[model samples]
Target: MDTHIYTADDLDAAAKDIVEGKLVSFPTETVYGLGADATNEDAVKKVYAAKGRPSDNPLIVHVDSEEMVEEYAMPLSDEAKSLIKTFWPGPLTIIFNLKDNVLSKTVTGGLDTAAFRNPNNDLTLSLIKKAGVPIVGPSANTSGKPSPTIAMHVYHDLKGKIAGILDDGECQFGVESTVLDMSTDQPAILRPGAISAEQIQEVIHKPVLDERVHVADAQVPKAPGMKYKHYAPSAQVYIVDSPKDFEEAAKWAAEQDDKVGVMATDAVLNNLHFSNNVESFSLGSDVLSASHSLFAGLRHFDNESDVKSILAQGFSNDGIGEAYMNRLNKSAGQKHFNK
Candidate 1:
């Protein structure tokens, strides 16, 4: 039960462990992933156990190159090919009909479809190449908690629970990858991330459907971050859209019997009034910075222990703001206050 942190220099050792079916946490451009050999059912089950993730929640398989996709999956549609041509080696995961015997059944949660992505990180690619097998992984944290953006974040949540961690530093994108389900007639985005739906639509020359746009309570989700109340901190989180509303919400929470915290951008932080009862954290000046700091901020406040509740300013779904809003909504569990 000893968990060690590995640097770039230790990648060979890490890859060796991974190939031998040891659970290793590695960094990707989007976030740190708790990886296991995709072809090994026991190794894949260890990933679910490490994260306390649901057995039914599918994992995303990461490959080193586009050609490897064909080895584990088959019957890729024209649309899936186009997306791979455009977004592979990036933060987009495309769902395909999984091939039999090549991948562990645990990876697909016993389903016929599997999600695939080729991360743009050199270390990750090198690890995959060295391992000589596809790696199926999920965010390196306990299920329902904020996703890990830095290697230490992985250690904080998963230390001793896994094999080893590759400390490649903070991830470029704080959010998880965009999960596109090509198994459907029309391509549907099961989750939003750095790659926006509009961007995908422009690439495909077809409208990309977002599952979040509609309310389908009865249907089960096909990807991670879909059916679960994810990215939550220990504190109760609420989103306030307007600056005026945020001020009111922050003040009200601070004055309550419980200790409170406020998460805001520089623009909104300067305008809000603070009391001894409330502690404030800056999400950043803009949406991009907010995206980078959102999860960390949530985790930071949680570490304080005294902060019982938090009020975060709602982000607009513009540009990378889409992913920012998605994480915030999940963290807050869709609780919002408007003026």
Candidate 2:
């Protein structure tokens, strides 16, 4: 199948394609999303096939505005309204009770709740508004792979499998949106994203629950990136949780006969012992930059012909570091040495 790349100038055509039940990959502030009309069952199914994503893993719906929620979602609670007021049109997703037969069955995975986000990207919002329906979108990449943060990353994973791609360059946030479940009395964070739990608590003045943040062995994922072994590269990944462990792991990888790669902060990279068999990448100094470059760095190492395996230095799970550590843990698939 032929997949065309669209731009901001071609919003009308892209919107038309989506309304016609065709899949389209577009950029959001968080990551590129493989989008389909959320109300159309056939279109939503195409998204699953394109990403090779499991039908059981629910998709998030992107709407143009908060007012659009009345059409696609069930009545919101007071707490849910507060959250939407605080974080809509940003890197935040909220799971609300699904209205009866309003959305495609494939979108909610037959559950009574659906994830919704009012993205900050102008092009994406314009396309959704033009399509006149909420678009259910997951990250534009093959499932269990690193989520695409750029247009080319989308093309690399889903070129011929989809309809078209809107190239808005690299995404602002290198990770997926923070997903919150507001169905229960106490809100729980299902997925960590650019927006930290602390930040969410600050907005609502209520303690936000983040079980997945502390519990590594949580079996069932309430949201994407939780229960699955996801965001992995082609090569094997191992996480070193401390500077001591990182140094030891790097040295150990260098001694191995197979080619190895190291993903670390500048300080960690500076401390590494370089050799012909090892390639090291600086994933940025601070947590935010680390979050922004994490996927790209993973993809970089995966594409390097000489790199056979990867050793990544883990970050502290504080503030945005929570999101960073979450992705690294999944990318490493819990192959970690904690010190």
Candidate 3:
């Protein structure tokens, strides 16, 4: 199946297809998203079917403007307004009370609150505006898989499964957006992304919730992408603390005759010594840089013919690093060393 790379001019036509209940994959600043008309139950259902996403997981409504988000979500608090003013057209998602006239339960997953964002990409923003309704979108990959950063990743995972893909090169953030629930008096972060929780708190002048809480399936989810095991790679991945531990593990992997892939920070990449079959990739100098390349790096090694096992370097659990570490831990699945 051919994945069409749409230019800005084609956004209107693509938006038309989405408005007609077809699935369209478009770029957000963080990652490419599989989008459908948020107000149409049938259209929103197509997103779940196409991505094999769990129906109960809910979806984030992508709007072109902050004003557009207000139409669907009623009574946005002053905190929500402040955050939107500072972070809209960027990688931040806010959860607010659902307006009475909002039509689709599928978009909210039967919840009273919904996640909404104004993405930073021009094509996506224009498409949402052209569609004349919010677009329900999540990362353009099957559930539990690493989020797609490039058009090919989407085509690789979702090719025959979805109707159309709007290739916009690689995603800038290569991760999901920071999700904050503003329905309550104090802002709460349901998920972390490129935007940090501390940053949101600074803007809103209140503490934000960063931990996960159990919710009933019958209720609407406060945030999308919160309930699932996400950002996983195909092969088993192990995240280690430092270069010394990674080197020790490499030796162990070599002795066991298992092909290993090492994802390291730039500081450690050049120092690691491994066999010809042991592949290595660098995550750059800082945590933010690593966050931007984490998924793509995982995809790179996941596709390598010689890779059987993966050893990933752990990052500090601060700022955007928190989100990067969360994805790494999820990808690792098991402990660093199997006993």
Candidate 4:
């Protein structure tokens, strides 16, 4: 298939692709999502094939409005309604009990529930409305690689594997949505993202279960990023837990035969004097900035031929920092600086 790149001027063609059962990646607040009509089984299957994603891992359905979500995944609790009102048209993805046979098994992974989101990007919102159906969207990169935060990243990983890509520039959140499973009586977060657990609790006025509960959650997962190897790059990534450890980490990186990549805040990157073998990507000035740039930094290292390892800086696991570490930990396989 010829992979066409779409811009704001050519969004109609992108929308048309989605309606015609073809794959077109669309931008969201979090990341570029591989879009297929959720109601079309064949179209939805193409997404899994394109990304090499596991069928059992499921996909998040992106809608233009609440009606689309309610139409397929219904019986929303009052809390669910509150969350939607507060965070929809943004990065939050909610899992609800699905109406039987409303969405294809390809979308729901044959589970009784489905994940849904109303993305914050204006171009994608227009595309969803134009397509006239919710779209099944997983990150537009190959399965188990860093999620594409830019359209070029999608084109790099998925060009020729899918139909086309809608270029809306960089994503705001630079990560995937917070996956909240409201399918059960006790609500729990299946994954962390820009939307923090504290924010969710603030909205619902109740203590909702967060990703910590998933350590003991052995049940079938209702969201993506669980039971799957995701966001890994070609280079082995290790987390440096303290700024003081940066020197040791740098020394270790310098000793490696192949060039090593370093991802850290401006404070660290600016002070570091690098050997010729070091490739550095900045994580901006703080944790919030780090969350916005983490995946891009991973992809940056992934694109470098000589990079064999990436030493990423760590942050306090609180607020949005928790979200940043969640993804970083996964990519690093929980490997930390022991030196």
TM-scores of all models?
0.95, 0.94, 0.93, 0.96
- Whole-model alpha-carbon lDDT for candidate 4: 0.88
Prediction RMSDs, each to the true structure: 1.9, 2.4, 2.1, 1.7
Ranking 1 against 4 by lDDT, winner: 4
The TM-score ranking, best first, is 4, 1, 2, 3
The local distance difference test score of each candidate is 0.85, 0.83, 0.80, 0.88
lDDT of each residue in 20-113, candidate 4, tens digit only: 9999999998999999999899999999899988787789999999888888876778899899999988889998998778887778877888
Cα lDDT tens digits, model 2, 28-138, are 998899999988898899988988887767889999988898776778777678878888789999988877888766787667888899999999999998999999889
Candidate 1, residues 250-334, lDDT tens digits: the string is 6587668877888888888898677778888998888888888898889888765578888887777887888888889989988
In model 1, state the lDDT of residue 28: 90
User: What stretches of model 2 exceed 4 Å from their correct place?
Assistant: 213-222
lDDT preference between candidates 2 and 4, better one: 4
Residue 191, candidate 4: alpha-carbon lDDT: 88
Best by TM-score: 4
Mark the regions of model 1 whose C-alpha exceeds 4 Å error after superposition. 213-220
Q: Which candidate leads in lDDT?
A: 4
CA error at residue 130 for candidate 4, angstroms: 0.6
Please estimate how well model 1 matches the true structure, expressed as its whole-model Cα lDDT.
0.85
Displacement of the residue 226 alpha carbon in candidate 1, Å: 1.2
